[model samples]
Target: MTGLTDLFELHHDGALAENYPRLPGLLAELTAEELVRAGHLLSRVDADEVLAAQPDQRAVTTVITGPGTLDGLVAPMTAETARHGLLLRPVLAGFDSYVFVLSGDDPEIARHQPDLVLCVLDPSMITRELAVPWEAEDAERVLAEKLDLLEQLVAGFTARSDATLVLNTFPLPHELSAALVDRRSRARLSIAWHEAEVRLLRLAGEHPSVVVIDLDSLVAEGIPLTEPRMSVYAGAYLSEELLVRYAREAGHVARQITGLTKKCLVLDLDQTLWDGILAEDGPDGIAVGGGGRGDAFQAFQRVVKQIGSRGVLLAAVSKNEAEDVRAAFRAHPGMPLSEDDFVRITANWDPKHQNLTELAEALNIGVDSFVFADDSPYECGLVRRGLPGTAVVGLTEEPAWHPRDLLRDNWFTVTELTGEDRTRGVKYKQEVARKTFLSTFSSIEDYLRELDVTVHLGVATAAQAGRVAQMSLRTNQFNLTTHRLQHQDVTRLLADEDSIVFTIASRDRFGDNGIVGAVFYRRDGELAWIDNFLLSCRVFSRGIEQACLAAVLDHAFATGVHEMRAIYRPSLKNAVVREFYPRYGFTTHDHDDERTVFRHDLALPVEIPKHVRFTGEIERPVR
Candidate 1:
């Protein structure tokens, strides 16, 4: 069976096998069923021991249940406890832990309350009679009602303690045919069941105290059901070899989902590393192109390249001449990565901080996404002061351990790294091209006139949804009100009659800044309230924000809206835009310590900035 070994070999070398020789032997002896049972046993044993041993640091706790147990009350209750245990494991792993089954109706797991309660349920425990047919519309309704009861149980558990509650969805079984006996419509029923599970999971995720564990996706990959041994019990009956491998893989994935740190290191070239400058070294003369001491820099570059490939943005901020660097990228055969690998390159002799700021602007990414790597401590300190959000790492550390250290420091653990991440460097290069083209123009109008800047305003598409949600999370400076929104929240607002969320895309002489800006607003009679207005800092000073606002206000006025209301909510990082609303003709209507409200009468058409030219027809919500 193609198992964890194959997946591991694809990304990692034989390091895992070499490190843990006993693991293979242990795995080979146990059947898949036995391994699953053992895992549960180990979890329970570990939880009891860890909780009993360390009580002071136990901030969170969880309890989980294995599949196919149907003792009714006991099974559901145990499942709830297990769910909490699993969800809070990452949070409490460094601290204390707890797990216990309640014997009586005294549903609270223990006399002392936990800081958090995590409840998990196995779909197999719910009676076949209770299971709703996948085709029935009432299936969701029934599931919701059941979930409500489960939530209430969790509430009861956390009643004595100030613990938050979390409910996890049941993982769907792997075997399709066993669950769907109706042979003719098995595929349709399976699809429906999967959809139903997702809906239930989403509902759980939306709960105040719930973090839905997407275990269905976690376990469903690999281990095909075509094999008879694997087919039984939803293809969970794997050979002993597969079971042990699967556990380790699952554990790793779990760790990724819960791990902290999500930024990357960007390096600088030249005297930053070796004794001599690369521009003077002329490729072959450089210290990095050979054996001995050169190997360290080569190893560092290899590590940086690997990190970049794994979704971390690798950027270059150097003081050397740009042409010299370009030559090194093209001519140097020893180089691990080329010019195309870097997301942003600022090689001018300008202030390092200014270069970083320009890099941030060009990438449409926040300064927080950056971790500057330079050999000079002076430069690192300067950047730290200029861009406080950015993290800086020096090259003074051990040369041999630098690669591993860099990876450890700038680790970006994620369940899935999307396609956008892979092409990010290329995209930033295109942005650089755009900026260069803009530089050639004598005036802003000339640039806009020459480059056909088309602003396609549309309701948020699925592709654009992630970017919108990301903007809410990462954007600060230009965000009118820094209200972070989830993807579902954005979707709901877009669908609501009282609200409108629009994204702006620009394709000009350079390239496309795909959905670079998003604005969300709602109307109240004649007053149009601005909920959110944020533009990518990359497209700043391009008059794109002005154009977007103009289009929105024009649309609002034409639709019979007399006034537009906006709020300037101050944040520690957004001090640059303290007077943003006032500058845009908004009069101060109300003020408090926390927030300032401004209103503008939409009587006249606001002058569009000369640098921006709107096109391709805008469709706005009419009041």
Candidate 2:
């Protein structure tokens, strides 16, 4: 089989459309030589050439600058962005198109206000004391000063704009100490580097906009010192290999910040999870623990478990007998996974792709949200070719590489976690029960009333800010504008006196559905505009949407606003809600190929659904 790197050489000129989305996966397979070659080739391609070749590009503006010589970085980074953009184009309505202004020449980073401000720095630029820390008289004091400078740089940018700032952390050199004991201890080299990394990370946590790339974490042994010839001749302080690696990693970070994160991880149970095929080698006979290849499988399972804990839904799609697989989840003493960890488990006689489609519906997430990992190339190929939206990982036959292969890609990347993230898996599992309960009811209206749905519509509270932001990020199916916002944006809206944000939380007899829907609108002069309107697909097929819309209309009427405007920007995933406004008596005020502008006259009466209950005793029922 031809390697992924070989495939890129044939299609790097943007000649193929079907191959664009697969470039990021192929880029990961490049050898050091291939990576450098690809980087150089990309650097030569101009933005106009890139645009002419691929008109499907999403215009993403960015300014990349740092404290050192980033001139050589411009071309390679641009190439990486173009390729990464092509990969993300299909999934992200459009991939980011980046244009750069040199580091010192143009410092309009905060002025222009681009989508991303990527700051890259070298470890060699650290405190002079760090270079010879073993003999420095005041190493600790010098280190503290350097850290303060780093903090100021990050804090200053965050204060200027809410745009994402991805700053690379300092990498520690292994040669800092000859003794392993001293290197691991509170000695000068270890303390200086480790404390600097910790402080930068803490600053990142304080602001939602700051994202530290963690070069320190990506390379544990630290990056190799620049060769004397390359440093002098080419003005390069880092190896070409490391530079190519960092470029790819940074590209992944950009995707996450822009809300291009995957939601679900589907796995095959046989050789993928454990060492042996389950039915052939019974639960006890399966190679699961000790010093065998089973140990490698254990390591891979731990990584998947860690991701699940963070919020990614885990599912099993295998051809084993249903009861046998359930028995393994229960009986396998060495299994790190439980039945609770998986939201959907399909172990049946049907084709794997058929099971995956049902899983996507049950989860209420797009097929694009899934990343399937299986040991069989045939199975992985089946899903990749049949369902192009789902990202597929063909796990290596060698067990040791499983974890490394999966984690290296960062498929489920997110800029930051919300309060709802930790409970995401639990909520989906509860959804399984919700599906079963709905089956017990006959009529649609009766089922909704039995749900006893309560939507609290008003200004959102501090606790609901994360969920409000999450609704914007995750609700593409029912979202009108597709404006993905972070919690800080929601917080700003809540603090603004003119803008009002509404949150809808539902609890059926089932359980607390949490905050599943939200809206942001403002009254300007005599007209009120809907800035964002989104509802989670989990709450679809109920009267929740109609009730939410009615409440928004009533709220606008109470504000003494005469007219209302709603906008819809077309995207592949949001097609379901295209005709929503016109159905509710909204007139088409303006029309375009990409967006439709709808206006509603507030003089007309609003029909609030009777099924949805309201809390906080603030209901101005218009019906």
lDDT of each: 0.56, 0.70
Instruction: Give residue 611's error in model 1 in angstroms.
Output: 5.6
Alpha-carbon RMSD of each model: 14.6, 4.8
Shift in Å, residue 219, candidate 1: 20
lDDT, residue 275, model 2? 84
After aligning candidate 1 to the native by TM-score, how far in Å is the CA of 504 from where it should be? 1.3
- Give the worst 10-residue stretch by lDDT in candidate 2: 89-98
lDDT of 2 by residue, 493-536 (tens): 88888888887777777677777888788878889888778888
lDDT per residue as tens, model 1, 1-623: 23234323422542331222122223222344444443443333334444444332112243322332212112222222222122224222110122223111434444333433333344433323344444333333545565555545544543333334434445444453365566655565455556656765665434423345554543455533133443244422223333333333333223222222334457778644333576666655776648876778777778778877865777888888888778777777777878778866667889998888777766666776677777777897688667755656666645666664455322454423445455555556777777778789888778767766667666676556556766665566677777665444565676788888888777666766666678887888888988778876656656677778878887788777889988777765567777877777889999996689898897655666664557634644443
Model 1 residue runs over 4 Å out of place are: 1-264, 270-282, 285-303, 306-313, 318-324, 343-369, 374-388, 395-400, 409-423, 438-442, 558-562, 575-579, 607-623
